[model samples]
Target: MTTTTYPVRVDGALDDRLNRWLWLVKWVLVIPHLVVLAFLWIAFAVLSFAAFFAILFTGRYPRSIFDFNVGVLRWTWRVQFYAYGALGTDRYPPFTLYDVPSYPAHLEVEYPRHLSRGLVLVKSWLLAIPHYIVLAFFLGGGTWFATQNWEWSVGLVGLLVLIAAVVLLFTGRYPQPVFDLVLGMDRWALRVAAYAGLMVDQYPPFRLDLGGDDPATTRLERRTPQSLPSASPREPTPRMSAGRIVTLLLGITASLASIVGLAVGGGLAWLDLGMRDSAGYVTTDKVTLRTSGYALASEEVTIHDDGATLLRRLFGDARVRVLADDGLPVFVGIANGADVRAYLAGVAYSTVTSPGPYSTTYDDHAGGAPSTPPTELAIWRTQAVGPGEQTITWPIESGDWTLVVMAPDATAQVAVQADFGATAAALTGVWIAVLAGSGGFLLIGMLAVVLAVVRRPEPGPSTLEPASAGRSNESEDIH
Candidate 1:
């Protein structure tokens, strides 16, 4: 047996070079770290949920979780740079799995970008598809499941599974690199986001844990530089990353929620107006009522609240029992049998007083032209009446008398409105169901994408040539 002991150097290396960025990173993250992390994590989480559901519904998008994480990371870094004054300033972007200068004798491994740009963009923008599908199934499905008398449990489970499968499958076509990077961020951030997004799904939490990644493991010992560039390239330019993806999704979701909120609020306001304007009609007789629409009987209506009634009157039936005309009930318009029936149903027609229809033999006054005797014929057509210009003409003789009545027309209009509510609900339900079904099929197509890159794995930088960053492109091309 042999024992070898080396002299211990107890003094810490105070002269060791420090990464200037270390201080910035430490202080920058101390207080605001959680806030940024929370916002970014929530964003990506929502995106993941939406994207997964979208793939399920539409049968489109990349499916690899690693690639998805990468995309999110890239996006988040760019957003951070811009927000933190790094972009358009002299600071590097944050959380970039790419562009993270490799530490000396260290590795910068990343999951590959297997998806195409066209497909990736399409998937990114259409994340709304899943959101809508999820919303529909949640609200509409719940309603249907509750109201219907069918045993929908088994079918529901099958349907939901199908949807999940489709989403996973469809996403396989575009194994986005940006999304992969997001998952590669600090484990804590990734863990929190995962918890929010995959709570109900088969998707698991981050493969790596937070605060577990060591900076020293990836730090590099760069050769002394001749000079640092006076004006550094604009940092945090928009780049693909998992974090960025989350940001985009969050922005979209927030916008969508705002629009929906406005619409619902406006609708509630309208309902309130209708309730406020409600009134019970009071009619005296069967007058030829003219209005915008129909008239309903009280039995057909259910007044939930009280409202005001509008009374519009023309120069007719209103009473004038004052001075000069001595108690005359000014009946100034046409009359009919219904009016008389309402006024005095059983009274004898012959017993009705002075206002009687008279018929006489031909009078030979002024060469056989029959007299222009007063009759109820001309009063059949309703006379026009406006406010002032809206008038009523009496075709009856100067002393002729006719009866009139007051009627209201509000109840009938509500009957026409009754069908609108049920119709809208049915239509909305149908569309939502269709969206959910589509999401399921979409998920089926995403599985292939997941398989493609999930197996590809992240590679070490040992085999990689350093990026054309510090060196000139012309020098490499010439070589």
Candidate 2:
């Protein structure tokens, strides 16, 4: 057994002449790649977690899983190289996970045969914390945390690359110094990723091996022969069958759908609670009313039309309750300004008065007709017999209206209360049903995905491949 430097290697050659405008559109051009990578990363996360437990017990990273994960990293590096990582390549990245010899950006990791079971538990998360902290400043941290707020300055590598891109756009050359720095940062990040993924036991170095080639290879003198630890029978690489692919796809789809459902359901539930519990009706501070032979006391009430949905409008209503302490009969009626004015004008001896449109109080109650006639609409009145307490409710509509309270024969003090109901009980049932149904589909999708990832595929003769055959040779060349 021998010791060497880090096993992960990342390399990229800066293209001589980059297109001035291409960098601007590179993000758009790579949308398809980003979409595919999104799903691939999800699979990668699941596989990495699975590999964690496997290594914990068996002391080996599954060779097939290793290759697939490496491919994902490789593919991601190429896209980043072309777009924001290094701006090192103009050639479009290939969609396949297998290496493309012609592609400018490359990444490869030497597979570790026997992993320390004890280290596997902490290295990916705990041991990698320092590297993660450094990479956070370099790469701007993981987008998952960055997305929680508006702070966009997370990725230092991306910012520098953009500067390099601008320099390239104007000067037609990617600065050598900038490119080297970007690569160093990228290399550092990838090294941390590999370590955290359980691909290597050698903790990543704090040093930045800048430029297209790794500098450590020249410094490290001896290389140990890589060997698998004695363990359970090695299984052949599993070929992903069409059925397995479908199952994984179903799982991914369901997981994504469940996220959407949860978000929507949670939002709807919040809205429903707000509507049902909101203060629906507005009440005025008690105003003194003189109850005497048809002496009308008019209090102006204005209702603002909330442009709510038709369903809410259909289920919503407004009610006015008249309360009096004198126990004398009180006549209460609600009408748009015009009808009340007409009715009062016809009464030979009655005094009709109201407050200004914006005024909530009726203090300036002057004699004669109101300066402004209330907008006329339908009118509702309680029986003139004056039941001390009466309530009238009507479908809610927006407008400025007046509440006319009259004492038929006696003088008594009184006040009116308005209550608004904005939601129906039935809607709560509907929302619950929607949440339950969406949640059910989401659970099914998640189950499908977990099963697909946890269950090992069947082995076949065609699935056998020498895992060592594709190990990166760049390290040897660089050394």
Candidate 3:
């Protein structure tokens, strides 16, 4: 009996001995391969796009383009196998696009002389959707249209390779079973890739053919349907161990926690930016005070609302300073619009001075005495004696305010200096904390998820009925 062959074939052999620490550095070693592959893939995409139009028109894939694209895939596979892709080989991948027979990793695709003009338009995209969905879980999910900015998960195959690398690191032996499963996945992915690349017409099978060799090629000699050589009939599907399940669950939880932490940290950062002060102010406004008995001078200054949210207003701060030249004592107080008006209304004799639209000055004969005591909204107050200065700083809220300067026993000339500013360093600290915490959590979660997926259990062994029984029944019927 003649056997049929699959057009796409991918195979690899695990190195007998692997350097325990080499896997860690393979990422660095593959930089040259990566740089070259980057350009090759770009060409591969352009050529593939061109091939699509060619197939659409002529019902034939150009042989030269097909070979070159296949070579790109082949080169990529070898680098992946040697490094994070499979960790099945320790041999450094060569830089060439052509096949190296001595290299443990190999890939090939048979070119078709003719293709269906109708299928060419849809097969690579529409008809291949099912296979694409399956491959997403194995090779990492990404969008077809926005491939340049593709976001992919750490897929099952990558996770499995990572597990193999770690095992090799500790025990110095690549686990055969793990390698077999990883190879099977790689084969499946490549076959799909070939089909989508327009190299073959046959659809990729959903079956998991675990081993270094292609299962389809090996099954050709047998007349009966091929079954898994080691799977048991009772439990055909693979079962993950308890430890692996626990690990996956932990990974999932950690990922969720990390995502939540990122949100909270971002919110904190926004709040800090909105509330914290980024600039400082030093205002030196001149005011004259009468040295005669019971004299007071006041200046009304507008504190414009900066449109900050109520929470930010509640948390902000402003510092005020009052200085006098007469070397006597001065009493300074800040009162709101209503309090300033009522204080001036009750004064027996007073002079009013208007500096700006938002401010008004008042001279009082009662030494700044008010008909009623100051309101609680009076935000700040201080006393300056002699050449000494008075300073008061407090959390600021938004409103129109008045600066009241009064003579304490004697009159004087005063220079009122007030400073207001924000704590920007606090905002920066919050932002850094958010970024570092979220980034760290995300990194750890991704690693854990990959490891958990890789360590999942393999499917049970399959049982096959004897092929001779059908032959014997036919012989009995003939007799």
Q: Best candidate per lDDT, number?
A: 2
lDDT (C-alpha, whole model) for all candidates = 0.29, 0.64, 0.62
Taking all chains together, each candidate's TM-score versus the true structure is 0.24, 0.55, 0.45
Whichever of 1 and 3 has more TM-score, that candidate is 3
Off by over 4 Å in 2: 1-3, 46-66, 114-126, 141-149, 197-201, 217-250, 262-479
Considering only N, C-alpha and C atoms within 3 Å, which residue pairs clash in candidate 2?
139-155, 140-154, 140-155, 291-411
Residue-pair clash count for candidate 2: 4
Reference-based lDDT, residue 72, model 2: 79
The segments of candidate 1 whose C-alpha lies over 4 angstroms from its true place after superposition are 1-49, 55-70, 73-91, 94-186, 199-277, 280-479
Candidate 2: tens digits of C-alpha lDDT, residues 142-183: 343634654455588988988988888788888899999999
Rate residue 63 of model 1 by lDDT: 35
Model 3, residue 85: C-alpha shift (Å): 1.2
| Candidate 3 lDDT, 1-479, residue by residue in tens | 11545767787888888888888988899998887676566556556776888988997876556655776798899998998878888899876555665789877665565888777778777988998888888878655454357555888998888888788878998899999998998898888888888877877778787888776632211111123333344532333456754664565566666767888878767656554433432233444333332334445555556744442443345555556555555555666756666655644434345433335465544544334433333434433333457655544556766555554432333333333244333455666687788779767765664464342232211111123432344222110
